[model samples]
Target: MNRRRTSRSASAEELLSTLQHLTARAREEVGLHQARVELAQALQRKMLPADLPAFPGVRTAARYAPARDGLDIGGDWYDGFLLPDGALGLAIGDVQGHDVEAAAFMGQIRIAMRAVASTVADPGEVLSRTNDLILSMDSSLFATCSFFRFDPVTRELSGARAGHVAGVWATSDGRSGITSDAGGLPLGIQSGQSYPVTRRTLDVDGAFVLLTDGVIEGPSLSIGDGLEEVRRLVSAHAGASAEELADRVLRAAGLTGHEDDAAVLVLRNEIPSREAASPDGG
Candidate 1:
């Protein structure tokens, strides 16, 4: 009986030891995953602009958030800057995947777009040149991109998109919807592809919302459903300022448990007074 008790005691000890080892291993794996997420988030933040460019009669805001649990590097980016021709240049894009290669490709495409836009004024030409550059990169990566150049003085906003969602414009006057022709073949798919420039006039106190798909999509939601949700959110918060509107959209998206990263850019055409919206106040 003494020998039997000894053997059972040794077996119990071994079982406890095995359980402790497994628990420690799990903790280690979690720590490693957390470290990678932090690193990826840091890299994403560094690549995307922290704040939108501001000028007289023009207000802009952007939000970029990387998911907290992913082994892949975030491949979403948004950029807003003043072009050399005095137009506000805005860009948002999503690379094909979320790996490090995708992130690197995003950066290169962004830089190339900015450089090309600075020299070319038309949105189609800018996108056409950007697509050419991507094809030349010799990678299998593709991206959905949108670019808009807004002339605050003229209130004319012109831009082109390549397989991206439409830019949403909302106003206090109940005029709101997605821009027309908001998509094309994804960049890097075909060289010499033409991206048509869609032009629209933004009356004062109006807003334009541009974002990557992650801003609206969900695990169970279809793209159409996600996009409608965005339009609804924008309409629901139509009266807010540019900065406030950006925050409201994000809060409304409720992306806490979102599987992918999201980036949003909001642009508002502002004026000193309502009469400034037109050449004559009559």
Candidate 2:
């Protein structure tokens, strides 16, 4: 009886020890993962712009959504700046992978694109330069980007796309139009590939919403479904400011089970009549 009791006690002790060890290992893994996620978030914030520039003649608003759990920050990014010709430069791009490396590459490409645009007024030329730069980068990396130059004075918008997801342009009356082509290759994939530049005139009261694949690619929603959701939301709140539009759209999308970082920027052309404001640039 004494021997049996001793054996039972030993077995219990061994099981307890194994459980403690396993618990410690699991905690270590969780800590490591948390550290990695924090590092990635920090890096992403550092690489992307915290605020866009204010142009004298443009009304712009932007939104960026990192994954809900602080997962990897994808290449979904937007750029807004003033061109030399007093037009607004709008850009959105997605680097191929949703990892730290892709985010870093996106940073480099975005900076290069801004540099190119500063010197080149043509939207197509700026994207072509970006494509060339990306091709010289790592052969395994690829990116899709769209660039647009909007002249508020003329209401003319010139755009170029390098295989990015299409953007939606909505009128104040709930009508929407898709504004991208489907043939251009992503940057870093080919050296000589050229992105086609598309030009159109925005109605004095129209707004454009540009987004990344993360916004549409989810297990629960198809691209068409996502687009319709966006359309309905924008149409319902067509009179709201760009910033308001962005916030409402994000809320509508919700954060439940979202596996990818999402971002969007809304550009609205609200050119008040000459009688609406002072001539000294209000």
State the C-alpha lDDT per candidate.
0.80, 0.77
* C-alpha positional error of residue 127 in candidate 2 after TM-score superposition, expressed in Å: 2.0
> What's the CA error at residue 37 for candidate 1, in Å?
1.3
lDDT of 1 at 101: 72
Query: What's every prediction's RMSD, in angstroms?
Result: 3.4, 3.5
Number of the top candidate by TM-score?
Answer: 2
lDDT per residue as tens, model 1, 1-282: 999999999999999999999999999999987776666666676778766788777789988766434445668888998899788999998888876677778888888999999999998888899999989989899999999999878889898999987667788777778767755787889998888888887765767899887777776666667667778778777778888888876654554346777778999777657566676864
Q: Which stretches of candidate 2 lie over 4 Å from their true place?
A: 69-72, 180-183, 255-257, 275-282
Worst 10 residues of 2 by lDDT: 249-258
For model 2, give the RMSD to the true fold.
Answer: 3.5
Q: How many angstroms is residue 75 displaced in model 2 relative to the true structure, after the best TM-score fit?
A: 2.7
Look at candidate 1 and tell me the lDDT of residue 49.
71
